[model samples]
Target: MQTRRRFKQTKTLSDRLADEAARCRAEARTLTPGRRREMLLRQARQDETAMQIEAWLRSPGLRAPT
Candidate 1:
C-alpha cells in the first residue's frame, strides 16, 4: 500500500505580514501608522480579506492601544 504525504499549509499573507511586524518590533524598528495602515488596507480591501486583518489585530500581541 502506498501512503500519501501531507504537507503543512502555506502561511497566509496576513500571517506573513504579522510576522514582519513582529520581527520589526523585536528589532526595535518603527512601524508607523501610515505604514501599518497601508499594509492593512492593502490586505483588508476585499471580501473575507478584512477578516484576516481583524484576526491579526485581535491576536494577543497585535492589539491597538486602548
Candidate 2:
C-alpha cells in the first residue's frame, strides 16, 4: 500500500490574498449586476492588499543582514 504525504505546506499571506481575489472575481461573474459590482469591489481591495504584501516582501528592510 502506498502512503499519502501527511504534511501539507501552508500558503503564504500574499498567495492567500491573491487566491481570495481570484475567487471573488469568479463568483462575481455569476452574480446579478448589483451584487457583481459589490463583489468586484471586494476583489479589487483584495488584489490591492496582495500587491502591498508583495511590495513589502521585496522591501530591503526585510532582508537578512549579510
lDDT of each: 0.59, 0.78
TM-score of 1: 0.31
Give lDDT tens digits, candidate 2, residues 1-66: 999879764986677777777777777877788966696967768787877978888888897768
Model 1: per-residue Cα lDDT over 1-66, one tens digit each = 999999886997567666655554544334456766565544434524555767877789875779
User: Which model scores highest in TM-score?
Assistant: 2
Candidates in order, TM-scores: namely 0.31, 0.55
Residue pairs in collision within model 1: none
Worst 10 residues of 1 by lDDT: 40-49
- Candidate 1 global CA lDDT score: 0.59
Worst 10 residues of 2 by lDDT: 7-16
